[model samples]
Target: MKRFALIFLFTFLLSPKIYSQRCGGGILTFNIYTLNGEDIKEFDYEIFPVSKELLQKNLYEKVVNEQNMNNSDYPLFKSVETSGRIIGKVFVDQIIDNNNPKLNAKLQELLDTSAITQKGTITSTLLFSTRENQSFPIVLKISNGDREVYILGNYFGNCDREASLVWGDKVLKLE
Candidate 1:
């Protein structure tokens, strides 16, 4: 009985650490394009998932409150809450397989083909916070080759218009 108890306790203590390391988060990839469809930049972001406690401690109060108050406006908040599951699918379809039939068809319908080009790789990290009854608030630290851009906003909602860099005074949209 003593040995069995010891074994069970040891396993229980070790399980969380092992599980967190493996399942805490995932990588997200995306392209940056001019409204004209020119893909001038790409990013491979590694997101580290955080617990509710950690999120609250790290994120800004306004960001957290906005997520709680405007839950219905942002679909990406749900993805962030789940630590990028939905966003992962978007990344796969949009960034990994450009020839994916469904996405390609959709893009063809929505965008002009003349301006799109695939190029560049930048690495970055995403940060966020969540409450029990509210959506998550997210921020991105985008590394653009030699420069870094910090984007502050909810995951899928309108990013701060002033937060963008690299476009050199031109207003660009992030799809």
Candidate 2:
């Protein structure tokens, strides 16, 4: 019984560190708001660390599917290229190494809401290429990097569902 208790305690103590190591060096949150500026819902989207190549491939596939290309077209090609440039270029490092033991404290600071919203030293900005009309407005927050950069994006209802980053908070505007 004593041995079992010791093992349990050890696991409990080590789990947080183990879990933190798996973090993809970034976090995203979605906030939903009404037209009147009332917050309706908020949730976290667990973004996985991925290589730039993988992100490009995924973005290409997403554009292809959404455009429903029956034939090769210049417009479609341009759209795909633009989307890749916007998202892929902006995030120079898609998968940050949060597992670095030296950066543990920094990662924790990056994940802190107050630190990000108020005291964050890094300049935060929102960048998106395509604009679409929607019934409701969605807000997305992305936190990443050792120095921590936050990205805010406005998602237009169903149109952005396919392109929106999965690991972050997603706020959907309700009709």
C-alpha lDDT of candidate 2 relative to the true structure = 0.33
lDDT for each residue of candidate 1 in 1-175, tens digit (9 for 90 to 100): 9999999999998876532232332222233334445354555433221233334444423244654645644544444433232222222222232434654453333222212222224422222221223222333434445544433333322221112223333553343
lDDT of 2 at 14: 85
Per-candidate TM equals: 0.29, 0.22
Query: How many residue-pair clashes does candidate 1 contain?
Result: 0
User: What TM-score number comes out for model 2?
Assistant: 0.22
- Write model 2 residue lDDT over 62-113, tens digit each, in one string: 5566545445364544333222112433443443333555444433333342
Off by over 4 Å in 2: 1-32, 35-50, 61-114, 117-175
Cα error of candidate 1 at position 138, Å = 8.1
